[model samples]
Target: MKIFKYLILLVSLSVVMTGCEKEFLDTEPASSISAEQVAETPAANEALVNGIYANLRTYGVGGTTAHTDYGHRGITAGLDNMSNDVVLNNFNWYIFFYNYTGRVQTSSRASLIWNTYYSVVADANIVINGLGTLENRTAEEDALFGQALALKSFALFNLVRIYSPSYIGNESAPGVPVPDRLTFDGKGRGTVQDVYNQIIPDLEQAVTLLEGFNRSSKQQIDQSVAQGLLAEVYLETGNWAEAASAANAARTGYGLMTGEEYVNDGFDNIGNQEWMWGADIDSESSTVYASFFSHYDSFLGGYAGALDGYKLIDANLYSMIPETDARKDVFVEAGNEFGFPPLSNTKFVDATSSFEGDYLYMRSAEMYLIEAEALVRAGQVDAGIDVLVELVSSRDSGYERPALTGQALLDEIYLQRRIELWGEGFAWFDLKRLSKPLDRTYEGSNHRDFGKFMFPAGSNEFLFQIPEDELNSNDNIGAGDQNPS
Candidate 1:
């Protein structure tokens, strides 16, 4: 049952494709088959691109995946053990508590994540390579190239962070399998530097491709998306000035949502088209709920608003949030209705008629926060603190966290990020990037630690073990592909 549950995520990945086939035209168009035949048309290209997004919701190895949603079990449990949050359930939360030897195989989540990231990249590759072949490529084709590049870069960036440790001033960290922009075959593990190198080029090209390209709605990636991603990259690389500038640019196009808008109907996500980038979910087409299969949804008794005691928010972080903030509602917490639900962490699961919600990849708040953080990091302390204070003060009403700078301001901003971005998958990413410790706790959370890490800050607990299959099939890597030591 332990391993079998992982299969559920894989099953979800398979269904992301629109299985309904469209019959070919009855005409005599058998002249030849070209890559353009698949992507030159909007419908075919859209379907191809959609397939990648669908697969992205599966579990593990980075960025956006079903793991973000499903990990709630392991995550809730893991956090609970460390005292960060309270677990509402105990079904199987202990799996992560210790390290053990198990034959490695590619997980549905890892492979799907790999496939999604690359397939999307491949789609972008197709856009890059097939543009000339396309019947009417035009500026839209170039815009897609930019979108594809940004998407691929984002996925690669996340994949690298999950599979590899922080740069740590050394270049040898075992990053995930990095693929060449032109290949379709699976490659072995690339070094952290190798993976990092691939991203900047793609993003740089994407920025160039998306010059002046603007398409509203977070579902479609455009110039702003490119800028937002670049800012994130710069921040990660410690290029504070460039990061701040890029983030500020993205902020120009978007910013924090209004109090009411922040808590949309129930889809309670940063996406919902307000996203700088996000997944478009169709109830019929997306079985996100099936993969999520959690108590946080409709069954728990009301996590955010109701719960079954399956998951909760971190106590430390939870305590830090001011009472006046409207964003505080994002977490239900232990004392809310029964105290078992702990913190709500419902920033992503915004479903009114259902327990599910449309997911977002990036949002305006992130851009705003990035700009603020970048400014502080770049020595623009007052400028940066102002940004953080504005957002927090607005959210918390009467609260003001002081004009903090250095570690204090950075920590302040990060806590809000965790609270604001919790459940949407940024928790692990942030921890991994900053190399923090995981310390989650709960009454009945299912996941446990590999060793002694707590809730949301464990080492590889932040990253995932590379699925074993790739190592066997390719023989270029090994069982424990990530979270080294």
Candidate 2:
């Protein structure tokens, strides 16, 4: 059997990884071989890792993955729903999501996101086990196994957020699928706790597995990435002090980027400082071209410019951004091409290679924010406020706010989250986690709901109908039970 030698990716490969999808599996990236061949040697592991990343980069069979980033914002005020012929058409779905009835859902974005991350988990398993089957160990063999575990744990953490309700709502809410750790099996939806529990062990294993190994952002799983991911999971689980510790660990090892460095470095000469971990996607091979930023109103011109009439920045929410925020400059008006003010989201906009240089899965700034949240949640309110203010001040000089605690402090954190993470896809879960009110306005432009709002959660509409196929195909788990009103 024909087999190439390289089994693991280099840090630089992270940026180079995305460009050529078609050639990915067949052509060797540092190495290549069939799965059976990999069971014999470490060469097949890279192909498997490539497959895992593809799942993260592209939407899968059901298209449930879109919600993690763009769609998350869509459900929140970061986006304006243009075709609001109904509540669903209008983002007013946020208003009355629980009351929604017409359950003709296509892709919740979160659903696709969940499926894709699971695939990443599976790919990690393949690498984890396949590496063991090899005889003589090489640096290549070790790298493949370590990277696989970190990436897998990373994917699972994201799934927990979307599928399971937030930490605030139900600590025990049923979460999403918890994938097989050492093996790949797509079956089973774990309770929210089950999935959350699965992540910590996996991450701990990754931390141990990846010890001493070092590589750039692309092919290797470094200590900071694991720590950063763990901190996030801890926060999600409301282990505030642990969350703060992990964030501190992550931030300490990976230095912070100055304000300018955070914005420009990742794509250029300063790349090392800003990213703790990110997918290295290049210009030529990128399919997404930063689609969220592509819209016309962006002035920066991303894919959204051509898609027409969909994904507007919510006027109600946009108005809340104080003019002083450097972050506010991230959104640009595309000149109402679809009709309304034509606000385009540009935070992800990268002029390099269709504006989607690479997908940053984790960054240093998040650790700062994570620490701030965790500290505050742990009852160190003033300390947390100090961290947040220091961090935000670096991002925008004049942007200022008074120290706050209790509910008020949390609210301030929430506001920053909405504005800062906007199109990066953190909104829907935030609202749910915070238990924000849901209501709808029917001023939708679509033909479906010329003017009616509805709720799709809690009382009016609880469980999203299981994907049509699962209901028809999987007898073990048919239409899921609805959420309580």
Candidate 2, after superposition: displacement of residue 327 in Å? 2.1
Best by TM-score: 1
Which tens-of-lDDT digit does each residue in 1-485 have in candidate 2?
Answer: 00001112332133224343654444455333445665555555665665555545542222433322322112322212311111122332222232232222333432333334544565576677667556676776666676787787777666555444665556566665554544333345546767667678878776666677666434245777788878878877788999998988888855654556445432322256656654455554344532333332233343344433234445546666777666655455556443433444444445553545555556677778888888999998888888788777876768666656688888777777666555444555554555554344424222233323444443223233334443344343435632332
> Candidate 1 lDDT, tens digit per residue, 1-485?
11122322223223334321222111112223235544465444444444454454433423234433332232322323232333334333222222222101334444433444444454455445545345656676677656666777876786676556665454686766665545445566768778778787788778888887766445566777788888888888777899888887776755566656565434445344346675444454344433343334433223323424355565566667777778777667556664544554554443533533455566767877888888987898988888777776656677665666579878888887876665555655566567676554334433333332343444434455565444555555555554443
Per-candidate total of colliding backbone pairs: 64, 48
RMSD per candidate (Å) reads 6.6, 7.2
Cα lDDT listed for each candidate: 0.54, 0.52
Superposed model 2: Cα runs more than 4 Å off: 1-37, 59-111, 131-142, 167-172, 181-186, 253-272, 288-297, 300-303, 307-312, 332-343, 353-356, 399-401, 439-465, 480-485
lDDT, residue 122, model 2: 55
